[model samples]
Target: MEEKYFTPEEKKEMLALSRQLLAHTREIQERDDFKRIRHIISDGIKQNHYRRDRYGINPTIHNLNTAMLLCDKISPDRNMIIAILLFNLCKTEFIPTEELVKEWGDDIAKLIRGLLKVSTLYSKQAAVESDNFRKLLLTFAEDIRVIIIMIVDRLALMRTINHHPNEKMVHDVAYESNYLYAPLAHRLGLYAIKSELEDLSLKYTNRKTYTDIAHKLNETKVKRDQYIAEFIKPIREKLDATGLKYEIKGRTKSIYSIWNKLKKQKNDIDHIYDLFAIRIIIDTTTEKEKSDCWLAYSVITDMYQPNPSRMKDWLSIPKSNGYESLHITVYGPGDRWVEVQIRTKRMDLIAEKGLAAHWKYKGIKSEGDLDTWMNNVRDILEAAETGPMELMKNMKMDIYDKEVFVFTPKGDLYKLPLGASLLDFAFHIHSKLGMTCTGGKVNGKNQKLNYKLKSGDTVEILTSTAQAPKLDWLAFVVTSKARNKIRQTVHEMNNRSATLGKELLERRFKNRKIELNESSLMKVIKKLGYKTVTDFYDAIADESLDINNVITEYEGLDKKIPDAAEIRSAEEFQLMTAADDDSTSSDVLVIGDDIKGINYRLSKCCNPIYGDDVFGFISAEGVIKIHRHDCPNATNIREKYPYRLITTRWSGKLGQQFGATLRIVGNDDLGIVTSITSIINKERDTSLRSISIDSNDGIFQGFLVVGVNDTVALNNLIKKLKTVKGVKDVQRSK
Candidate 1:
């Protein structure tokens, strides 16, 4: 792609602004030690040039106009800080320089990148890609200033979206603002940005609905304002009489929120009760803040009868994001349901700015508790998978899921996703604890691993080294940490087997003096059209690799043949079949057929489970073994033993519990396992015999065996397992 340079006029304007910014930057540099800020800004501008070329956008006056508008929305000082942060963040090689380019150049680039990263913190994509979560977590972990920059960036974008014309772009920006930015602003206590983003997103995402509701609200604007003014009169007088300073203001619910209420409650515009809310901001000491708020509420209720059900006491135990207010719905004059929120000015600011406000006023050097919680969120996101749909679903669940506050035996409170299981509790304590968790006790009562934890429940996870993850536990455990630990353990075990298989193949090849170079072997293996070397090794390690076919192709090329039959196959084949079976003449009967005078062994791949359809394969050792037809080795044996095949059926009585393995893959969720177990146990006759589950990057793979009667019952069990929350696919073990 040809490089696109700025037009003379555009360059002149940008250069002029750049020079102006540079001059002002000198003062900030001396005051705040921003020495490297200039270099960062220069680099950002160069990078933006690269992106402009790639995106095929001419650096014309029109584009410059958009950039100028963006600049207008941003403070130069704040943009400078954001620029420094972005330069530091983009030091990694994976992020292309072109993608990091900003139209407003480097000054805005820093802010844009910081904002993008922060936006990603609550994004669906962040949930799927662990690296994204790690990046975001580390960013927040280091300095919350990055988050503030991000919020500011979004606010600026929302303000300047009018410059863009793409409907899809507009809708996306609006949806993002609504679902992610708005809630995040609310969480961070950036009420101004939060409310604006919500209103903007609502305007675009649901224009018709927003317009209808907004029109209705506008129609009643005068009456609503007058009513609110009248309603706050008595409360203001009462507070003045109590000798406390206070200010009263009125707020209407955001249009988007009103539309949601209309849809959820199946109500019209007129039926919305909390449409117009009155705010009572008071000035009080922290120690007496609650008392003063309650006193205000009492005064308001005395003048207007309060609806007991409509009262919310967030002041007692604030939200996870640090929102605090006393919300009450009272029957106002003329039977109107007037919502009132009472809080001190400090509380109001905190409620508006969330964690940001906390940092600003508290002047705490670090994020402290908020950082810890966000780190946990990072863990969840890192363990989740990526993709638009997957991210959207999982991100919504993680960021917006209802939280339950549970206590440890030591009285420390841990906030967990609602419906979290005991396993989640265990993992929340420590990753190792989750891996070794056998069960747990909720409030002094011993319960299964799948036990649903409730708020205020004191949980103690039962763990042991001997108690590794059972496949069945995958059904009951919730929380990404627990799921990720389970997945890592299972992957390690599978990988060990794969490694062993590779070694076994290498040793066998070496015994024949055949040099097995990995590169050469892989070429030959690929020529045979195998998908992966591991698949070939797994086949060989499982004694399923067809050496006869391999050797037949290479016969006479080398002269290591002792006999024609032995030469027809490979030496590896002889070693595999040389085991003695004659010493054990046990006639193991299966499926009403007796293979006399031959040793019989059960295949571990399928476990046969007593009632599964089975077959017998005669080995070179004269051992007749039973295996399910769906076993991984079945296809090889079937192709080799077309004439030797014997149809076998099970005659044994069904057992209450049979050993089998099920592989499941699905979208990850907070309480997936618990939901699965709840479904399984709901039948009462079934038990989760054992389970091993692992999840990372939003993909969940589990191996489970549950108590069942027969194949029919197992299929039914799988059918039921599919209904478990967050489960995508369940397959019977081959």
Candidate 2:
């Protein structure tokens, strides 16, 4: 309940711990580099403290102290203790890893590297949470001690969380503690640390739940203590008679756990029977360890009637986290159900301290237990999308989830995340089986691919060669393996389709006269607005494009007209005669495929401007005639002579003269024609070739023929012509 600063008690303990650490390790005080290593870490800590404060960062002195104390508590390994001392300093970049490794050795250096990775795993990033978590979860491969150190570090920080000033920081820390760290701790069999971390996290993340449970527990502490004393009296008497060296303790449910049950069962604290459990820890040698637990279990059951359904014999098969115990519920005084746990002292120690203790008291069975535990953790991470948000979003389902053991057709059991689907099961077997599986029978009844599987169901996957992965399969499948395999299959299928389509296009182009370049073809494809070659080719293969027509679209691109009436491909016509910098030879701008070595004349019927939409036709005079698309004779000409219709547009530059006629309407006023003529003459590049006017009944109408360089110049002239006295409108005549 104190704001854990550098109190005298902590200082004394720190002095004692430092002395004990120096006395124990051959790598540190017993070596030539002891003073140097100590100086480096000590100096780094001071500088880091100053740096954090200088940058308006929360000083982590208390956090460092807490971590150091925790390291000593978890293990007396000097490498770890010194690593803890310098971990924060290195994380904050006040000191580098080279300094530690150079002075101390590789053992310390390796642990520091693992600590650095642990720092990165929780650093804020743009990536989703699961990605960071996936890498973090795999840190066991780096050094088993890294995770042990990390778990202890997290426990230390949670214990001193009130020191953090930022509300968001506190929330993030607490959230990760509850959802990630505590679950990890529980998995490692660090029951005490796990429970405390949960309670601390709930205190910050959900204060109301934490406070309510703590308040209720506190108010009834006297009555609960008395009940525990009374309940253990008979058990203690029986255990003493058996001459088993042991310790009996009463364990209460953590506030967070209690709060969870309260919300789940909707029960008051008083109604929550078995809110605490009695743990019987007996001492035994290695040979009699299993027998001792059974002996203790019998003693407790003899004093009470055991519930047959509420018994768990984990002593026979220890938990994956190296937890070995016999758990049972028995009716106590006044018919109240009380849970009990019996374990050997070594088992109890491992249960209390988790992986660190297990490593200290090394056992062959513990090694196997850890292998199984770590394999499960790795499997969950490997099979799932381990993005930051992905893992964080489904932490409840992945990290703290209850496991379901389903049987394959061969009766072999496979553990899956709760709510795993049938498709997930198939993918778990093999990617190919998953892709080709159509459906499966769950417990002899047919079920869909997305059916949520339950424990003990015997699944028989039905597969067919015709069955292939679909795009929609990603929506229903949750496992990363299934989703990624589906994506890979889709990609391969698309590539095959695109290859075929590209081949068909190349052959089609070969049948035509013109050559096709992949670059030019791709340019045209993109200009048509397709995102990728895959989409374009998929369309081609699916009949969305007429391959023949598309191939011909590019043919005759550079055609030349030799005879008057000779016609080429009715495709885009390009006026390639115009030079890039010099457009004086052409009056009209042309846009389309190249129509080089051809002379074209403007048609008299439509008098199209430089920017007007036009088409070309080979005339009888050995020249191409260009006409506006909306010309009076355009429809009749195109419908009667479809092959003669060629798509084209004018491509003219500034200072190139083009001809257009304008019509004007105005009020009949004196000097109106003269005023319009003056305005047109004022334009920079204007030639008023001719003008005609008629005035009657106070209204005037005029027609003017003009030549200008381009649409910009012509538009400028028309705008000035509209400003003439009494003028109503001026428009280019078609």
Candidate 3:
């Protein structure tokens, strides 16, 4: 071991924590495994395999803390503890997987592999809010223990983050804990870990509010304890007479929960009822667990008036995470409502330890529901073109929602999130069924495809050979599978149309005995204001652009051709004011004040307004064309003609107007177009040159071509138009 890497006290603390962790797995403590693990770590230290993380926290201490948390709270097995110990060594490649497998076994090696993959993902600095990152996390975590270990690792980090040297690291870790890890823990039924994570997150992120709540809880501890004791007194007497072997304890709500209620309900802590809950854990056999819990519920409700709406019977159908409990809110002493939870020892274990406890009670209860959910995860991860973040939002919604159990006509049950539409269910059963579904008969009643399903409804789907998915189906389906499939189908349809359109145009040229010139066709396409050949062809297939018009433009290209010196790319550019902040010497073009000698103009493909990042592309004709850095053609220009590119920046202000187009969509309310025109007319130095409107299904989509002095004027017009009545969206045409 490297002695200089740690203080004497630090080394002693790590040694003690390591011993405590091994002790949880008694076989490892008794055998030579402990010393072997220690030797591996010493070797890792010699090779510099372990070091402080980016937050400047000791790796050894952190891993030990995480392992101890797993042991003390989760009741994990020997392999889980060993994996946590050697994870860092394996991650750094100091210990190869072959050696790990030969010594530690395959389970240990597999856990470390999952951890390493997740570690690599983190090194990319992906945001916690990124849905793709979250999906990939689950994909990498094939073993449930990998997720459990990660959750505990995050908890360990949160507990010691006060010692972190970087404030930004502290804040980011806290935010990730709150938004990402906390919800995951909740989903897994690790309520204790979830609550602690949320509370610690509040402590670091909002210290003032955390301190206020902490002080209030501390100040009222005495009175709160007395009230709980008084409330439990009579309930204890009733259960004791019944000769039930049970333990009852009072649990106060975490600081974060209190703060959330205060903020949401707009009430102080004093007004928050159910601030504490009384839990009753019974020692009963699995066969009698349900009956025993019911007996306790009867005894408690017999003594006090029970609120019917406040009762939750998870005992009948346990939660998706296998959490089983009976909760009842009763008017306790002083008429204050107090919540009581009744559960067996087995149920309590699963509730507190999540999947770890579920592993122990594997066959005692069916995990088919959980298995179904895991399969849904795989379905969502299928190859699709949708953005990962969008997919993640849909997945997160499913994770946080309560399941609605519906049935097929044959009595096969399917679980969906709350508010799941009929289409969502059809997709959940099978993708093909969902695609062809027009509507369904729910419990023998006809319902539309958009009908929201409820529990216990037997659904029989109705389909037709002529029925096809519509673009509007994306608006109703909530599942990512349905949404992704719809998008893919729509994209395929457009591609087919584009292909057909291309064939039709080519056949027309063949029939007319007119030779098609590729370059001339390109010029015609550009002149038609189409960015790509696909869009041009699709327009022809849809009959939006007349085929004869395209041929006429192609024939006229020769007559309208400019001289070589005057020819420039069809792209637009802008001149920024000298006052713009983006101005830099390196970005400025080397064109001097003798500007008349240069026959250059802004390219028409990308409209680069004033203050936009601009670059100069020297055309083959020696005409320098200014283009926006983000132009659609910029990538091709940069990749294929790197030598022709020159760094350019907007210089002196040119007191002239530039043309821009805006696309707007909103309700087809009375005079909505007039309202939009009025708003644009009010902006100074902004003029609307032309407008075209199309309306369908009470919705209107329009395009407006306007001339503005600069991007500033264009943006101002957009903002003012956004404020118009019935305007849902307004943005510059890309």
- Candidate 1: RMSD to truth: 24.5
Model 3, 1-734: lDDT tens per residue?
57987889888989798778766667434378778887888878887898776666888888889989986766635677788889988888888889999987776787888788777655445456643344446655656667778999999999998746787888988999987787666555566888899999999889999999999999999999999999899989999999899999998989998898789779888777668889999999999999999999999999989999989898999876677889899988787888898999998866645432432232223234443554343333333345211243224323323556566666555667778899989888888888778799997999999999875567889874324466788888888888898788667766765775686578657744579999999999999999999989877755566575687577666664445455232111111222222112232243433233233446544556666778776543234667778765577668756765666666555565666667788887756766877887788777777675555677777667677778888887888888988889997764
lDDT of 1 by residue, 477-543 (tens): 7677777788777665445435645654555455434666666666666656768876665554444
The TM-score measured for candidate 2 stands at 0.44
lDDT of 3 at 548: 54
TM-score of each candidate structure, all chains considered together = 0.43, 0.44, 0.46
- What range of 10 consecutive residues in model 3 has the weakest lDDT sum? 569-578
lDDT winner, 1 or 2: 2
Give residue 702's error in model 3 in angstroms: 45
**In candidate 1, which residue ranges exceed 4 Å CA deviation?**
1-26, 29-150, 163-165, 213-223, 281-294, 313-325, 343-368, 371-734
> Candidate 3: misplaced stretches above 4 Å?
29-31, 123-125, 130-135, 234-249, 278-734
**Top-lDDT candidate index:** 3
The TM-score, computed over Cα atoms with residue i paired to residue i, of candidate 3 is 0.46
User: Could you tell me which residue pairs clash in candidate 3?
Assistant: 570-604, 570-605, 571-603, 571-604, 571-605, 572-603, 572-604
